[model samples]
Target: MSADARERGRIVVGVDGSESSKDALRWAVRQAELTDSTVDAVTAWEYPPLYGSIGWIDAPQELAGDIKGAASRALNHAVKEAVPPDQTARVHCGLAYGTPAAVLLDQARGADLLVVGSHGHGGFAGALLGSVGQHCTQHAPCPVVVVRG
Candidate 1:
């Protein structure tokens, strides 16, 4: 682990390629720069079992491809593009599997701050805080910031 990682944890932010999430990533970079804290940009996934395989089998090739593709695109944007130039080195994107809320809540355990986007990629306009955001706010181990964008 690097010296920065040994500091006061990091600012964990959830990203799903949504406009709101992208905006949240941008804000998180600024926060990370100001606080001298790294940003953990996370995107959780859940892949179905492969054909002719047991439920306990490893993830299928297609699913793995999807996971890698999504993670790559998201990191490129959320960490490289969404994050401001001055804070690039402080931003790190991580991909995981499971429910968004559960993933974020778990990640928050080691986080100094938890940030989430209020609106989601596929959510309706009526929802101020989308289901995932609401869940995180209710169960997060650390203070949560629900950014609206």
Candidate 2:
């Protein structure tokens, strides 16, 4: 990374393969362009909870790998779909193993801004802001921009 880019600061955005998230990614890119800043496009994943008749069960290692791979692919696809080809160089993709809100918060620690969609895949359809977005806005170390799809 160039010193100029670092001086300009970073913009962290959450991507969840949802329409709303795509909108947020696009918005973040636009803001980055205007500010001459770099963008970190992040997607988070976690092992699904498993249960057996006896009690909670551990997820297979292969299952965990598959889930992480899916998250990676989704992040790439969201970037391809939402970011313009010419401006893609300004965006860096990241995949973290954790809840979306927590991962985003960690990524935004020193970032100039954090961006998220109003609603992701897992939330009430009519809600103005999804749980992740709400949590991020409430707890992020930097300012937040919530984009609507």
C-alpha RMSD of each candidate structure in angstroms? 3.4, 1.1
Total residue pair clashes for candidate 1: 0
Question: For residues 34-106, what per-residue lDDT tens digits would candidate 1 score against the true structure?
Answer: 7878889998877755555444665666677777677668667766658767677787778877878898998
Candidate 1 stretches with Cα past 4 Å from truth are: 2-4, 48-61
Predicted structure with the largest TM-score when compared to the true one: 2
Question: What lDDT score belongs to each candidate, Candidate 1 first?
Answer: 0.81, 0.93
How do all models score by TM-score?
A: 0.83, 0.95
Cα deviation at 89, candidate 2, in Å, is 0.6
Least accurate 10 contiguous residues by lDDT in model 2: 1-10
Specify the highest-lDDT model's number.
2
At residue 99, give the lDDT of candidate 2. Answer: 89
